[model samples]
Target: MRDENEMEELESVVERMQQGDRAAYEVLLDRFQPSVFRLAHRVTGSREDAWDVVQEVFLCVHRRREELREASRFRPWLYRMAYCQAVDVVRLRSGKRVDAWGDGEEAHAAAPEAGPSARAETNALADEMNRALSALPEKFREPLVLATHGKLSYEEIAGTVGCPVGTVRSRISAARQLLKERLSAWLGND
Candidate 1:
């Protein structure tokens, strides 16, 4: 999931955290909060809920830090907690599934220099993409979001979602195909 240097940094941080270093825990929080929020937001489709999930994840990590046997396993362990917490929040909150991908702020912010027409086009495309993502089944959507937004590998996704690596690959592939089918018009495939 992370590059070698990043993984090394994570391992060092995790080792310090295992030793009850509060500063190391802070480092972990600072390093992973955004990506964790992104994964939670994509899976839960609510910024508020995602924030809740992120808080719960870090809390759990801090409480159960000793349960982690390997420093190398910290990343996926954190992500698994995030994935589970987000799903639990969705289940508790009226059983409504994740219906939107994100608020499109990131998409808009990424292209702030664009002309008005270009911004409108970007917004339109973002809307279409969100719709396509929302239409996917949860089984497919979860793995895809974990891979794309969480930046996790298939093995990591499999571990987080509690499935085999092959199943994760299939779900991600199927999700992409579904998205392609849904956005064919925007993609100029018509």
Candidate 2:
């Protein structure tokens, strides 16, 4: 369920956006930029590519603002757009299928603030997690990222990925199991 305040705000933005208000579009961009970047980064596995995706997504949103009927559905709709754009970027760069996998270097580079030993451990774990997530097929990776990183409901994920709810559920479950198996080995549990 959407919060009343957020819903109201979104409605206002949508209304203004539909009126060709650039400021309103800017507001929407500001609100969604970080999430858009994160989703793009996760999908494309390149910060530069992610930035390009963000710009293209907002441009597409602005161009198609009138197609949006309900402000409440904007989150999932926007995610769908972002996902598509990121996939396109990946395809264009690779000239092949979309390979949704990170190199693990980016994950290791952005260490959280902590003591040296703790930070080192955290970096190692993060790199391992990135590698595990990268190994997942796009079908599994998309839903897992939407559910966990995007904080979307199963239904929302289904809508974003154009899959059934049960499929989304299964993919996420399978992805989690794969990650657990991979990480367990890294953690010396296997």
lDDT of 1 by residue, 1-190 (tens): 4578888888999999999999999999999999999888877778889999999999999999999999998888888788878878877885554644676677778888888899888778877887788778989988887888789989888877889999999999999999999999999997
Q: What TM-score would candidate 1 get against the native?
A: 0.78
Residue pairs whose backbone atoms clash in candidate 1? none
Model 1 alpha-carbon miss at residue 72, Å: 1.1
Tens digits of per-residue lDDT for model 2 on 19-91? 8999999999999999988888877778888899999999999999889887777889898889888877877
True-structure lDDT of candidate 1: 0.86
**Candidate 2: what lDDT?**
0.81
Best by lDDT: 1
Number of the top-ranking candidate, with TM-score as the measure = 1
